[model samples]
Target: MAEVMADNRVAGAKGDGRFEPIEDSQARMLADLYERHYEPIFRYCVHRLFDRTLAEDVVGAVFLDAARTIRNFRGSEEDEYRRWLYAIATNHIATHIRTSLRRRVLLQQAAEAGRLGPHDEPARTDGPEWPQVWRAIQTLGRNEQTILTLRFFENLDFASISAIVGKRETAVRTMLCRSLKKLRTQLKSVFDGDR
Candidate 1:
């Protein structure tokens, strides 16, 4: 398509030899950013939500918000852009959790009022240790959960995570250390119980 070719041309062009509209440049940058960063963001969301469809929807929403705010985005470096995008994804996940909690509360209220029929019990897990680990992760405070997931599951270093989380590197390291210690303690108890 002509649009694709135009985008490619503008994207590959360095310096201001040719005049490209501001909108065109921003669009090209967004497309490039999406191509490079979408998978990592999607993985992060999937890890947080444990639902592929919801993760995909959240990814779409994250990019949509990024595109809208791209004009205000600063820093031309890849790492800075990554931090910005991850920050957006982090906020979206928080919103998703709040909404889910609100819905659950409303459903519970409805059931208590006798306006809804009884529902089946939640499913039980009978899988490997990873599922148990994930369940234990849910018991952590929100900050602890986010730090552990970013550090371990996403394989991000403390420096990058500090940027995404808006925390000092030292603070991030401290929280990560505390979170890992707590997680190890929790896992030990589970293994002890199994024996």
Candidate 2:
């Protein structure tokens, strides 16, 4: 319990005070943060990039950036840290997409390839219908994909997803509903052999 309290205190301290902890606590917090959110962030990245390796790199970069900047973090009643962490993930994914056209092409190619290797597959979405579902998700605008990933897979509330994606909660909800409808339509077409 002391460790949790200390962590809370450390998180709440303002200015440079939060950076005062020795490297050990810093490392511990980083590790704890990774343990808590790595999978969700990775899933978000892979959903965006469609490549396991690049997704892993993006997730690593997100957490590394988080570790370096966490001292400036402010406290919140909700899972603020998790939201902040995912915001970093979202930014890293966007930057990667902007910087690497070839990488984006390769990722899209892999997604179209339909192999679903060991790691890149969505958990429950991996059944016979997965190919259609994934392809539909890939078709979404990047913002829609990011919001859907945060809302459905990460189980984040609309407000937190709005904060992450820089939209109003109502907009997030509308976009998510639209994205899902698009997916349903695409999946129906796929199963109907429209492709």
Candidate 3:
């Protein structure tokens, strides 16, 4: 059809000369995905980036990435699409944090202020500042930081994290455990009297 041709996303024609239906379905599915997933994705970005404006930019980039690569996406199930979107978000957040010192500083400040802690409990201001511990977190590799963030900050389980990160569930668990142990060691140094 003229509309399909006019749209550059059709990828290519089948041997029968019909535009790939998967691309069309993907487009439609993306529309629906935007309606359903936008808010949660925005929240994820906001919590991770600690700035509404920056989060907005990152969320827009995620969806734009989804649209740009929709034709190449082979997933037919909604869960697959959701995992794909989170994977995109993960990469964008990491890229944003790496490229923008401002965002990283903001996240560090937020963590220092206890915004990153459990909401049910208030932060213990009596203790020393958490910048040292967070600096140790920063020293971790990107994959380690990502695993920690997805598990602790986003509250995602190992299974979901494995799907998002394209790792085996056991690998996700091992990575998370290793990252946590490293953080605990840093925490011990920061709070010398504490375990």
Candidate 4:
């Protein structure tokens, strides 16, 4: 009888492993992670790319990458997973920017073959100050823009931004301050021109 009971318990365990019902635990875990991080990630991407579609694409890719690699994640008390996720996002954004710039260059070359006119002027938007601010942001160097995005849009601390960008915390802070000053100067020029 004892032998039969032991066999039954083993079989039950095997069946549980093989054909277990879907549990809400994993869903809750994923939801919690997404809820906590999605907005900041999306904002970071949007600020970097200045396009909603590209931001959405990058954010989706980041989450997908996280899901794929989650199995290897070891449980930790520290928020290591968030840091890892941000690192992945930073890499993805960099790759996307490179590929997009290459494509833009190719498109420009192709269009030049037909002797087309210069590219049309950027569209005017409704916002009074935001468009000017955004245009000034575009003038910043890539690293400056990245530092600004991570610092302001993502609301990440210098340490977190440093971790993402593989720089020292002090360096990141200095970069952010310098970038902000540059942006301010650019915006001033824009405003001066508008007057």
Model 4 C-alpha lDDT per residue in residues 90-186, reported as the tens digit of each score: 8898899788886534434543343322236453433234434555666677777777877777777787778777889888888888888887687
Best by TM-score: 2
lDDT of 3 by residue, 1-195 (tens): 324456555566677787665466557888999999898788777656666788899999999999999889999888788888989999998889879987687767776665664456666656654444556677667778777877876777787889898889998888888988887777875557652
Q: Model 2 segments beyond 4 Å from truth?
A: 1-27, 76-78, 119-131, 190-195
Candidate 4 CA-lDDT value: 0.68
Model 3 C-alpha lDDT versus the unseen true structure = 0.77
**What TM-score, computed on C-alpha atoms, does each candidate reach?**
0.72, 0.74, 0.66, 0.67
Q: Order of all candidates by TM-score, from best down to worst?
A: 2, 1, 4, 3
Q: Report the poorest 10 consecutive residues by lDDT, candidate 1.
A: 1-10
Q: Please give, for residues 73-165, the per-residue lDDT of candidate 1 as tens digits.
A: 877998899989988988898888778986535544543444432136443334234445665676677777788889988999888999888
> lDDT: which candidate is best?
3
By how many angstroms RMSD does model 4 differ from the true structure? 7.8
- By lDDT, the better pick of 2 and 3 is 3
> What local lDDT score does residue 89 receive in model 1, on the 0 to 100 scale?
89
Clashing pairs in 1: none
State the TM-score for model 2: 0.74
lDDT of 2 by residue, 32-75 (tens): 87897888888888767767788999998998899888777875
RMSD in angstroms, all models?
A: 8.4, 7.8, 7.5, 7.8
Query: Residue 70 lDDT in model 2?
Result: 77
